[model samples]
Target: MNEQPPGRRLGRGLAALIGDVNSPTPEPANQLAPDRTVPIELVSPNPRNPRRGFDEADLIDLAQSIQKHGVVQPVVVRPSPDQSGRYEIVAGERRWRAAQRAGLAELPVIVRDVDNRTALELAIIENVQRADLNPVEEARGYQQLIDEHGYSQADLGQVIGKSRSHVANTLRLLKLPDVVHDMLVSGTLSAGHARTLVTADNPAEVARRIAEDGLSVRQAEALAQTPAAERPSISRSAPAAKDADVLLLEKKLSDAIGMRVTIALKGNVGELKLVCRSLEPLDELCRRLGQG
Candidate 1:
């Protein structure tokens, strides 16, 4: 009588899916052997693959590796529903691209008969696990799954091995302007800095300053929090001077944790704050403090 949760419907987590794709050992008795060599021309990239850009240098490096050693891992594919004999790639497209550059006539493949939804899910899972998808691409992939397949944020977190908060935060990246999205795609701005700018009055201007001036994620957070009228045009503008010791300590703490650190002192009392761009650093900060 009760409704089942969507997260439970994600039959297996990323670990199991990854194992299915890249397990080094022989296939288990219960599972069908996905191993098969297919003509390179018969396999094509999925149009729906969430990853939009591949680094030329990284691909060339991979191609050189494939040329020397061959593709150790098989590319995952499924029979194209529209085309009679050709196959559509579900995962491992990067290796496929590299293999083409390596001039391989045939490729090793793991063929599965899955529908459109499962194909997208597999693609997203593989890319997300490998950290290959940029924040925008990653968020778009999540949105696609939700829009087309009725997946909840909790469902995505369960499938991808990320926290619900991580999923939520990543999705928020989509609300920024196109210029900000371009910054994310081009690697000019980090997800952390971009996250802080999402609610800024003029995210594009702040984002450009952050990139040009090389501000830390924490500094970007402070700038975003400040009203536009009060914010200095240049990041190097002078402000009320702090004690030399306090400035030194701030730099040291910021360097230690890779975030901005600030100290405020009042009559013999003080407050210390650490600015983190994302949950990962915050978790690390917590861990380090707990150990001490």
Candidate 2:
């Protein structure tokens, strides 16, 4: 049994609500009066954990720290719905894994009686707050919440303490193709580069160039904005020109929204086009235009 004083109730603050394992001042997510310390074997990792990849070197370092000085904070878990006498980890998976690597028999835990929704929310919040999830993982988590729980961008932003626009932009990374996704997950492409390539004519080809040339985000955006036929290929000529004033306006708009903007004018009766690769960017553009 976990050691604790009688009637030592935990609070429902964000630290507790989010299951911050590394919280300097730990607290509980609810009014649950008691906390328990369970055997490490009984505590299974959450399969739905938003954080997918863990750096092996960092894990080793964490294990060494645990070996020197045991787990400072307790992991948060919930009763497993599928198995009796088993618990599912809601947060602090890294700590638990490190403890196991450090050869620990048991560790402290706070077993909350939260439902599936709360469990997923807590896991996402914990990973996001700690900056543990990578760009792909972060976007996937947001998408999962939106898809599985019917969470709107505004609702997710409110819950995660972010602006809806920020949440929307982060979620846009998922529109990247498989090649770009691998590049992003492996750190070959930055979030900025990935976002710029979303609407490109050939994202995989452009992503290859970006990686081969070590192009910056701005450079990638410039390359993506260029017409495919006039992209300086060995077989292609230069691109057609627009009016100088129209070009200037397009540049301004593109810079403002971090995406491509185009204007076509025949006699002040032409169209203004804002090109967005995904719903997130479209939402961002709409928000900027005060239309969202």
lDDT of each: 0.81, 0.75
* Candidate 1 global CA lDDT score: 0.81
Task: Locate the minimum summed-lDDT window of 10 residues in model 2.
Answer: 3-12
Top candidate on lDDT is 1
Clashing pairs in 1: none
Candidate 2 structure, TM-score to reference: 0.70
Candidate 2: where is the Cα deviation over 4 Å?
A: 1-14, 18-34, 232-292
**What are the per-residue Cα lDDT tens digits for candidate 1 across 149-207?**
78889888977779999999999999999999999999999999999998899999999
In model 2, the Cα lDDT at residue 35 comes to: 76
Clashing pairs in model 2, backbone N/Cα/C closer than 3 A: none
Candidate 1 ranges beyond 4 A from true positions:
1-34, 233-292
Candidate 2 lDDT, 21-138, residue by residue in tens: 3432333452233276789899999999989888786678678767877775668888998999999998789888888999999878877788887788778866876667888898
TM-score of each: 0.74, 0.70
